[model samples]
Target chain A: MPKKEVLLEINHLKAYFPVKRKSMKEEKKVVKAVDDISLEIYRGETLGIVGESGSGKSTFGRTILKLVEPTEGEILYKGQQIQHLKGSNLQKYRNQMQMIFQDPFASLNPRMRIGAIIEEPMALQLTLTKEQRKKRVKELLQKVGLAEDAMHKYLHEFSGGQRQRIGIARALAINPEFIIADEPVSALDVSVQSQVLNLLMDLQDEFQLTYLFISHDLSVVKHISDRVAVLYLGRIVEIGTKKELYANPLHPYTQALLSAIPVVNFDEPKQAIPLQGELPSPMNPPVGCVFHTRCPFVMGKCHQVRPTMQEMNEHQRVACFLYDK
Target chain B: MEPINTQQVLLEVSNLKIQFQLKNGKQAKVVDDVSFSIHKGETVALVGESGSGKSITSLAIMRLLPIPPGEITAGTIHFNGNNLLDYKNKEMSHIRGNDISMVFQEPMTSLDPVFTIGNQLMESIRRHRKVSKKEAREKAIHLLQEVGIANADKMIAEYPHQLSGGMRQRVMIAIAMANNPQLLIADEPTTALDVTVQAQILNLMMKMKKEHRSAILFITHDMSVVAETADRVMVMYAGQIVEEAPVRELFLNPQHPYTTALLKTMPSLDTDVERLPSIPGIVPPAYALPDGCRFAPRCQFAMEQCQTLQPEVLTVNEAHKVRCHLFSGKEERAYAEEGSLT
Candidate 1:
């Protein structure tokens, strides 16, 4: 077997946003949105990032894209450091990377026509003629399974599913090699969600595009991802190939999260390990292991010392005291 | 239909028709001829996507639909043998919190942002029971504790915005279960919540129902939640129930094309499939519904007759019913004869 090409590499990336002080006497604080995360994305594989809300999954994605400036660490695309790239250099990186937002209605401009919305990205990045851009827009519309007439209409006229298709069209406008879809199908209906997921998979094969799909829905992530990462309070708890991680999740948080999902299949016996309390405030996260407060099988060491990601096998890695030995 | 024990029935809605007035003086029938009954302490899930009229049906039951723009055109909503449609506004208000309470999807918007959590909980309690403010406040703290909020006393003083989404939803549930209403109507209550939090809330709701012996009208678009919580399920599409069955039977052998398609389309955690078998086309708009079966346009087994004639509900068994042309008496006979010939 040949070695797979690494499309992107992130190293100890940290993104923090300072919180406003309530009063003069109050101490300064910051939200540790993405804290010391490192990962690799293969050339043509979907890497799913799953976490609860406020777990900083979205922040991690944004930090990698440089949409939100990282406070520390490196973001390397195609083995080149691009985190500090600015202006035209960053603009050039934008052509190779694009993001699809969660809410289609909010992401697409309400005032602009559908054709213009798809063409806007290309116009900013590429030196294509207006006529060529318009032709490409039509082709993209057809590619996403939308009719040509959709290009003439506004955002509000289309259904949620159609609008999401339009969002995908716009993301592919500049022929980006990588796309970060942040909960792209969460807003869509069940039937339509499958359609979009299928389209994404088809497009990946067609263009050899790598995806960083971030979502709270575990089932969706499991369906489309080649590898999966479980995040807890802005830190990765577990990361491995989809089959290895899902079938034999080493992290306690991952086990709880996998069990928490209310599976539609009734034949399987359910043993849900209920996590105690809500996610602790990101502003003031828990001491030591971020998950120690809620982990069902937490040991004393889990409360005093933070666990680093350790390899369980060739493919699976977990950040937990249970796997430390 | 199976023999339904009238004594055990908590809420019965029959041939319910709801319409919304459009700007062009036309009325759009949002909910068309919907009917179902919930037994005491049994959860009946009304499952559908947006514009499928699941929310509208629940809202109509609460008598919460706006008067001018939205109105119930026909049908009777019988709560414990009482027709809620005929009740006066004052009488309906009395029944709302006292007997049938609703939990909305958006907990933040449903709760009063300006008021403290204790203030809102006590208001619901005081509205139904003739309790003093002091007693109500104590009960509010107790209710908060019951919903799994650890620091009830501290939480009571906090504003809605101060609480997390999960905490706010728990507070909402506490308020809903304040009066121990005989029936609880939850409209996608956990849709906005995270899966872990959703599991917690769902557990709380189930526990509350068991303790109070209240029937739940659980409405959501998620099939997994329905499989988890519902005792019986009703799959709605384009404002009509396309299938109704016991929870186990619905999952095991769904007869309706829509239900079958929905179950297949949903990405399952237990199994791996190359590509999901998705249903083609979008749900038809309510104002311009097709003449024949509503799902015909998207149905894989749709016949020529299905395009022109609507199909009535066909009972597959004592606990299962499906509304599809493939199950109609004529089509059944035709298929039976063809099978014999083959």
Candidate 2:
């Protein structure tokens, strides 16, 4: 195997939102959407973040792309802290990190032609002429499995799968090193979903692009990710290689989440490990272990002292009292 | 558990055909000659991807299709041994919530925000049954508690906005089972929910359905959900029932090319594969569907006859039927390759 390069590193990243209350006199409340998370993204691998709604997985991805300003901590791009850069320095960093949103219908401007949508990013990032950009757009359309004529049509003229293809083409327009795909395939049908997933995988291989693939669907994330991370209530519960995590998940929350995914094969039916209660609000997240409220194997200590990420092995890291040494 | 009377069919839809009027004075068939029956206490899942007309078929059963634009051109929906098509609007309204109820995909939108959960549940009970406000309220709380809401007593007075997605869906299920209806139509009830929450809701639905012995028409595109909850599964494509079989049999030995493609395309949680065997093309639009098999364009085993000749439902076994030319005359065991057939 060849030596891998560290493309991006996040340390103690926190993204908080000010909560609005009815009474204006009340002290402001903050929703810690992403709280004290650290991870490393290699140059050419897909890091999947799986969680339920309001799990802060999306916030983490947005923070990585610098879409949401991090309340604290450092985001190192190629060993340079780029979290709070401004002016042309920020623009240069932004070009290297692009985002593919969840909804294709809303992500692509309906009024603009498909060609213009794909070229907009290139125009902003690259110093190419208009003619060169148009040529590159045609090449991108073909690479994502669309026809050259698709450039002239509006976004609504295409189906869900085709629209997603256009989104991929746009993401590749700037030739970024890392792409944050936030629930990219969740809005698509199952058949179309496979197509888009395959397309993303192929494009990753061809472009040697690193990805922060965020999705709530575990099956999809497992299918595409080299490493998987489980997020619960704005905290990373477990992170490991796909094989290590899927075969021997350590965190109680990870175990429950993996078992809860309904298996398709009937010969091997899964008895779901049911989790109690819904995900607690991020505005007032549970103290100590964020998942203590619903953790099946929770202890009294979990309600009082938060467990930090403990390295279990070379490839697996888990945040749980059960793994405490 | 009470022994279910399998002989008694709660709802029977035969040769159901539906079409929608296009803006250009043209009519497009959305569902054609679709037929199935649900026995008492049986859960029959109508499984298909989008544009398969599964939702439209469910809407037709509820008689909720917008007229002029949408119309049921043929077939009868027999509920409790009576043809529902014969019921007038007034009679249908009486039967809608009392004998039959529906739970939609998005519970937040399905539930009214202004009304309290208690108000909505009690209103349905009082409208269908002769009961006082006090009696209705008691029944409402009982239903909520049965659905596993911890603070049902205090939660009933709160509006739908106060509850989470999972709780809202549970309340929807509570309302659907309030009358102990003979039939329940769950149209992708868990599609909008998270995986963990989906499992919880599905477990609750199965438990309530067993206690009531109500037949369920579970409409969803997720094959995994169908495997977990359904007794029988019907695969629909291009507005037609391409295959129908017992749940285990369908997963173990899928017959139709479309069904095989679907089962193969699903990313299995138990196993990991480098790449899934995706079906080649999209489902053709309604107006431009093939003259014969709708899936022929995407079918890997498609032959010349498949493009122009319509295939009839061929019985492979007592509990399995498929609509594909390859299996039309071959022995069922000949094609069972244990996932290596493709």
Candidate 3:
């Protein structure tokens, strides 16, 4: 919760993908996918990001890793700003930070053997010898619940769940203190999801790692995160400790999103405050509070102006006209 | 069948078995010993993961299974009193998309791109009912308006590609309801759309169900959709009905471990837990399924005997039935805490 203890601080992160016109002569249209969002990942803590498909949760994760370059923003990693840091400096930052992608099948190269996939990062970035990297790869395989013989197999040889484990092993190969896991379990089957989750948790404990876990699956995020940030159309609508946010959500968008999630309990019917309208295109986002159009509690001020995140009830921050008072 | 107030039994599919001719020259039984009935004005959600044979079961009812690879090996799909499987192509023309219509997962691909919405709508109406082209166009516009498509007549003139994904799905629903089918088979109707768009489709379906007196056979992998619309639920696993009960009863008191695990895997929007609870192991390949219990290898409560002997569907209560050794009391051994298959 303290800024001093923050391992990664993302300040005003912006990612805009250029839309190329039919003619090469025409100027490209910039789509502001991730628009000026700021958040911090603390030491040994999981900061959860929840949003619908195009809410820029993935873009936020990718932006931090420099997989997709941020148009603007300062990515401060351990007190030093990593954004715009190029060549050797960027390479160094990548070594300190690593990511586990959503689709493990696509992330892991099919032609590469599991051992090579895991060792590839170490080979390029680290000063470790061949024997050392191999030894490290074996250790990572064991850590993620894969057998030593699994190393010799190609990426396609394993199931969805197993391929995800290989991905975890590869992410850990760089020995990063900070990891960005982007919907790591979404592509997996329900049964296999828990195994990979448990493995990640175990690895976190052993390594004392901090995680920026971005997922639309809130329940999964709640199981592992210390704090959570709720995103709506490229902006943080609500953020607080898991208990505070879930127990008392302030933003209308957060409330609606939460209501959509179906709990297993059937004894009590959920008061679903269903959201209004569809998600606006990021290419042309609405003015004022991005969620104001859908918010049931919208006020005159909500339409006219954006609501800054106001601090409420010990560490909770919410952006909404209802909370403006 | 329960006592019908306004709800009538529209679609009654009994003892359905579908088989596909395998490349190995063997017949692979996909839909085996499946039976469920839907009321004329109720939503019966068929829920399962991939390869649970739900899609195939829906296809079999429509008599739409591809012949060479897929054949309705056995069973009867009785809509009203007529067995649909026995109906000739000419006879089925009266029912397919007229009496019983289907909505697939991807609406974009399913909808004819080259054909204008006007032609598609008019064709369906003319096939079943003897109506003038003008009357059919008017009916098509009316149907489109009912499904909440904006400026119906203008939109009908445009092709499916001209419409957004959400609007395209609305057209699919309009086509499905053009003749007011007694049974609607929606196989992952909202799966392809984003959450916001998915919500709209769901709302539209729920709205349409209210306006039209028809049974909805909603098939989806998402448990949330089931919780939203289903009056009753039929949970399938490995081509078997693991459990079947009233919607509320099934959720509150799930007798099967599979059902419980499924419930756990779904992350509640309200419960801000750190990690999602999940079951371990993937669905066994169809060819490699255990002779005794298909779910035995992945089941946490699996016992030594479960590997060799199939458990019968034993009634836990009047409202619940489960196919597991734990419920059957055939295997008394507790699930070892640390040795969970996951």
Candidate 4:
């Protein structure tokens, strides 16, 4: 198979939020939401980001879409550095990289009609007449399995599944090359979640779209992602293909996270690695390794020195001293 | 393991029908003619999506629904050989938290923000059991430690906000187990926690239930939780019990189309599939339901009779029961004979 070109790349990305001190004598603190991460999103492949809450998966997606400003790092779009771009350049970057938020209800405008909600992106991204935008909105609605008459409905009129479809239509309205979907189907019910997931997959194939799918559910992540990244407090602890990650997980954190998932089959047994404690607060993460406090196989070095991502094999990478050569 | 007594029924609901009064002065049946029994020391899971009336059924058992908008229109809830519906509020209050306890989904909000963990746990102990303040405090610490809290002494003094989500849920479980109730109603107890934390909570619940020998009514949407904890599984849809069977048999051979569809839609970690087979339509609204089966619109094997006539519950086997026409009488017998031949 021919190599796929990298569509987006990140170099040493860091996003931190500084917290105010309670008093003058208290020291300032910072929440390392996304701390020093680097990876590449290849063209036409879905790269999934999985983690628990506060693992910085959503923040990382936001940083890539320029929704959240990076404290430090270089984000390149098709080999061009675009993080610090302003004005028209920034708008152009936003046009290429769209985001689908987790909550369908809050993400959509309550007062706006469905047609206007979808067409708003097109109006901002491209200079099109009202008639042209309406025409595209109707076509997009049909593509997402909704009837053309749905163009006149309000956000409140549709159910959770239908509202999610509308959210997808808005994301595709800009004709984005990269979509950072952050927990897109988490808000819907199980029966409805699959419908939305299938729709997203079909759209990805139809539009030839590359997706950075972010979710906390590993099973959902496994179904949609070609390559998967496991995040800890604020860092990518492991990255590999779905087969490599599922069949042979290198990182202990990844193993524990995957094993903890509740499989539907009764006889398909699983070995759950019960971590010692809860996830530490991002504001005061451990010095050596962020996961060492909860990691079962913690070595002395893990408490004194941080581990960096190292290549374990051809397609798998891990950030643990156990794999250090 | 000793076999549970099939004759000893802990909780039995007969033809439970719940109605909700809408704002426009109209009423709709939210839980329609649902009936099931929980055996002593058995873990039965109530599984369904949102608006399926699973939560409402659990709430009905607890008598927690708001009376203005919600009412138990018809049916009787018999718990421990007594009709809970027949009991007055005073008697009901005495039985609640003493014989039956519930653990809600969101532990963050379920706990009292102002009270310390010790204060909350002790309150339940003192309220249910006739124990002194000092004894209750000691029992509180013991319960906390029993639920796997390492620093039970200092942790009991901490407020709910200071504890993590997992710790808060453990505290909730500890409080629920303080009086050693015969029945524990856990309504999506571990849904909000992370996966690792969820595993811990589930393990802790199972261990606690085993030690106390409490029959648990585990309510959740995830089938994996059911597989891990429940002995019998009950699938609910549109305010009705669509299928009921032993956990292994239900997972291996689902009789209802809705149950099969639900199992198929869940993405498995063991297998790699391009796309999940999804049920097309959503659950019908309570106000506007189909004349026949609630899932007929989304059922792949739905027939003309399914859309027009309601099907009675048919016995698939000695333990398995289904409310679908396809599994009724001769068809089910033919399928069974075919299985025997195979």
Candidate 5:
């Protein structure tokens, strides 16, 4: 293994939301959105967090940046655990970690001009004069491939790809070493998608940034990620390098997820081993392995016992009964 | 199931041109001189960007293009050997949804929130075909089952809001195929859908094409979907078919500059590039199009002659055809020589 410098280390991260009371005497039920997830993000490397909807991939990314308060976990940024910090300390930590939201339309304020929107992050984190901030915003916009003069235009005036570029520029306002891009290119067209992705790759090289890029697109993950983690029903089912995960995927869930992607070539035929059913309601997930209900190679032990993450090889980790000795 | 026959043309559309009347009363062509023939049960994809006139072309064929602002100025849209563009409102109504139906991009907003799937499905059958409530209800269930709904019986009672996005889309497909239409027009059917659901839907549509023998004109921007499903592909840009070829041939060897750029811009899943390339500028608006070739501004091999003279469609091979000056060897060699020097 090449010297993996840990940028962010998260251990036993859990986020639970309170469910409504059924009766007056009933205790509030806790929705285990993110049960227990342990992860390591390396310096200047893209760590892909991938999952279906309601898989807690988005929650895990947000909780790491302290956007949402965690019920339980120890998040070590650099070397220090930043779980209970508040006020100035929390603000300082936030400057180091920035997040790009999924929806460009909802993430940006519709009323604000493009320039002001990008400048808002810098104004909140840094103390700079108006002239300095404006100059910085212009530079940031140009870096993201937006025109300098288009600062006066509102978010609605810009296209989906252009808006996402603005969103990226805002995330880069404080020169944050780490970024959490939550499905940044999912909304754009395929032609425009490559542009945004290329820009992201370019920005990463220029800044030496670490990315916790969260998306459902495995192809995108495979293209950019140094390490890819597959999440299923609030659990990281598999974690390995991009080559290991795609070439020889261990977990049945990962296998199904990868096979589901439509092969672009018409010449090559793929025998799809589809997951039998839809992901069961997150409110009432199955016992033991959450994926066992849909896993093609389900074992008798899988239904009764939950599989823990076990290292199968030097860099590959899989949570599946089939992988167990 | 309708048997596949190569000679049988289910929908033969020729020289179809639609224009929108501007505030000055002058008409601006949106779909200019488009022609294609779709065989029974064959999937033909009309592909392009936001203003490529792909969607408008589909709407024109359906005779659903909004009037006043929009009009099918010239062209013959022949479906089942009938001139559909010349049909009166009542005459066109019989063809619309009875012989041909459409599925839109946004499935969620397209459906009525209050109506149950049962009512919507039955309404289409009852409205078009002279069928009683009981027979229509049974057909609706069968239609639901045909589109891959697990419990078609129970799902019919549930409202649109009650079902998942994929299920609702299946319901929409059920309605489109209610009267056993020979043709189906789908505009970005899988755009709002996730890849898994999208795969399921496309596979479902492909399966249905085999079973029903329905000719489908699918409008989409997804190159992957086009590569996977389309039998014949049309590359539209700025209200013209810049290139048209067999699906495999188009991707493998794209002749047009725009088509080549589009293929290059897409990040390959199987192959990785050091830096993903992009065409420098945004697609120019239709209102302010270049006088000669619409794609000249974005074309990498644009010459001085490209700005002055418009190129006619040139035959590359038996199956492939492209509208480009490069193929004709008409490119200004002196200008090209100068370009190489710079």
Candidate 6:
């Protein structure tokens, strides 16, 4: 096989938000939303980021998109460091990258018509005339399976599924190369969810789009992602090809997360390794191994020392002592 | 598990119709001709999408539906052989917390933020039982511990906001199980929690139910959860029960076109498919429902007869039932042929 092109890369990315202290005597604390994460996104493959709430999945996506300024580290887009880019340089990068939010109900502007909503991104980035932009908007609407006349209606006039299609159309307005969809279909019904997922996959092929699909749903992530990353408290615990990761997860966190998913099968008995307690607060994550507090296979070394990412196989990498040896 | 006594029926709802009066002087039939019965110690799942009337049906059984806009337009709800619909407000109030309890989806909103966990738990215990405050507090602590909350004593003093999402759900389960109600109505209880937390909560709920041998009206849209927790499954689409069968049977040989599409649509954990087979079009709004079958607009096998006439529930076997015109007559052969094609 030929070598796959790398579209984006990040090295030791960190995003920290300082918490408000109630008193002068209190020590200042920072919520380590995305802490020292490094990963590479291939040109047209979907890299899924799966984590529970507060696991910093959303923050990681935002930091990569430059929506949230990273506190530290480098972001390389197509072999060029774009993290520190400013003004027109940064604006140029934004045109090639777009985002589709989780909640369609809240993401789109209720006051604006569907056409205006889809065309807003183009108006900002593309140098197109009014007629040209209008034609493109209608074309994009039809591409997402929405009617051309749908542009005349407001956001409220559409159903949840239709609103999501509009969201997709808006994201595709500028023909982005990389799209970060944060739980795009989590809000839709099971029936409608498939429709959106199919449309996304179809669009990705047509546009040669690289997707950073972030969702808590393992089933969804498994369906669309070529490669998957498991995030635990702002850190990537495991990264591997979908088949390798799902079939043989090495990290304890990754294994627990995978087994916890309720399968729709009755022939096989459920083997959910129930983790004790909730995800710890990011403001004060555990020392050393962040997942040690709830890990089923915690060792003395795991409590005192953090494990760095180690390659387990050509397609799989894990950050756990179990695989380090 | 002890064998469920089929003779011991805990709750039976027959031809239950619920309507919401729209602002435009129109009434939308949110739940129409829905009928089912829950046997003692059995978990009957009510599965549906957002507007499929699953939640509304559960709320109606609890007698929690609002009055001005919402009303039980027709049918009857009988609990423990007594007609709950005929009971007065005050009389129904007695049965609310003691006989039948509910665990809502959003733990953060369902819990009172101002009140401490102990205060809330004891309030339910005290309301249903004749107990002293100190005794109620002890029982509350025990209930919390029963739901797998460590340091229950300390947890009781904490407010709802002080607890995490998973912890708050544990507290919610404790309150719901305080009285050991014969029938427990959990409406998407674990939907708000994380997958790990969801697994924990599901195990806890099953454990509690086993101890009490209570009937559960488990309501959720998640197919995996339905497969894991429910004993029997009822698939609802647009205010009607389209299919009913045992959990395994429902999953293996779903009869209704809607049920078949729903099962195929969900991305399964055990199997990998090239692309999910999705149903086209959206569920019709309740107010503007189609003339005949509710699912006809989206059903691929929708016959001309299905558009003009509504299909009644047909018994496929003793364990399975389906509501579709395809199973009516000669079309049954067509249904089987189409089924093999998929």
Return the top candidate by DockQ: 6
Report the error of model 5 at residue B101, Å.
1.3
Q: What lDDT would candidate 6 get against the real structure?
A: 0.92
- Residue-level lDDT for B5 in candidate 6: 83
Tell me the tens digit of each residue's lDDT in model 5 across A1-325.
5898998999999988888887979876777788899989999999998898788999888899888899998999998989899999998898887899878899999999999999998788668989999999999999999999879999987778889999999999999999999999887766678788889999999999999999988887887788999998888999998888888988888888877777677766877876665677677778889887887787789888989999999879998888768
Better TM-score candidate (1, 3): 1
Per-residue lDDT tens digits of candidate 1, residues A1-325?
Answer: 3689999999999999999998979998999999999999998999999999999999999998789999999999999999999998998887898899999899889999999999999898668999999999999999999999889999999999999999999999999999999999999999999999999999999998999999999999999999999998899999999999999988999999999989875776698899888899899998899999898988999888989999899999999888666
Docking class of 2: medium
Q: How well is each residue in B80-116 modelled by candidate 3, as lDDT tens digits?
A: 8778888899998778988899999888898888999
Which lDDT tens digits does candidate 4 get at residues A183-218? 998888888999999999999999889999999999
| Model 6 interface DockQ | 0.87
User: Which segments of model 5 are wrong by more than 4 Å?
Assistant: A21-30, B20-29, B330-342
Off by over 4 Å in 6: B1-6
| TM-scores for every candidate against the unseen true structure | 0.97, 0.98, 0.90, 0.97, 0.94, 0.98
Please write out the lDDT profile of model 1 over residues B70-181, one tens digit for every residue. Answer: 9898999999999999999999999997799999999999999999999999999999899999999999999999999998989899999998999999999999999999
Clashing pairs in 5: none
lDDT of 4 by residue, B90-119 (tens): 998888888999999998899999999999
Candidate 3, A1-325: lDDT as tens digits: 3453978888888899888789988876777889888887789988999998789999988988899988998989888988878999889888877899989888888998899999999999759999999999999899888899999999877888899999999999988999999999888766677778878888888999999999887777877788999988888889999888888888788777777665555567767777665677887777887876777877777777988877887769987778656
The value of fnat for model 3 is 0.46
Question: In model 3, where do residues sit more than 4 Å from their true spots?
Answer: A1-4, A21-29, A264-267, B1-9, B21-28, B116-119, B157-164, B194-197, B269-277, B316-319, B328-342
**lDDT per residue as tens, model 5, B1-342:** 445785688888787778888886566778777777888778888889888899998888788788969977777988878888778999988888888999998878988989998999999899898988999999999998898888889988999888877888888888888877899999999887766678788888888766766888989987878988898898998898999999999988777878877877676567766777676666666666688888898777787767878778789898788887877764534434443211
Q: Give model 5 RMSD, 1 decimal.
A: 3.0
Inter-residue clash pairs, candidate 4: none
Q: Global lDDT of each model?
A: 0.92, 0.90, 0.82, 0.90, 0.84, 0.92
What does the lDDT read for residue B81 in candidate 6?
94
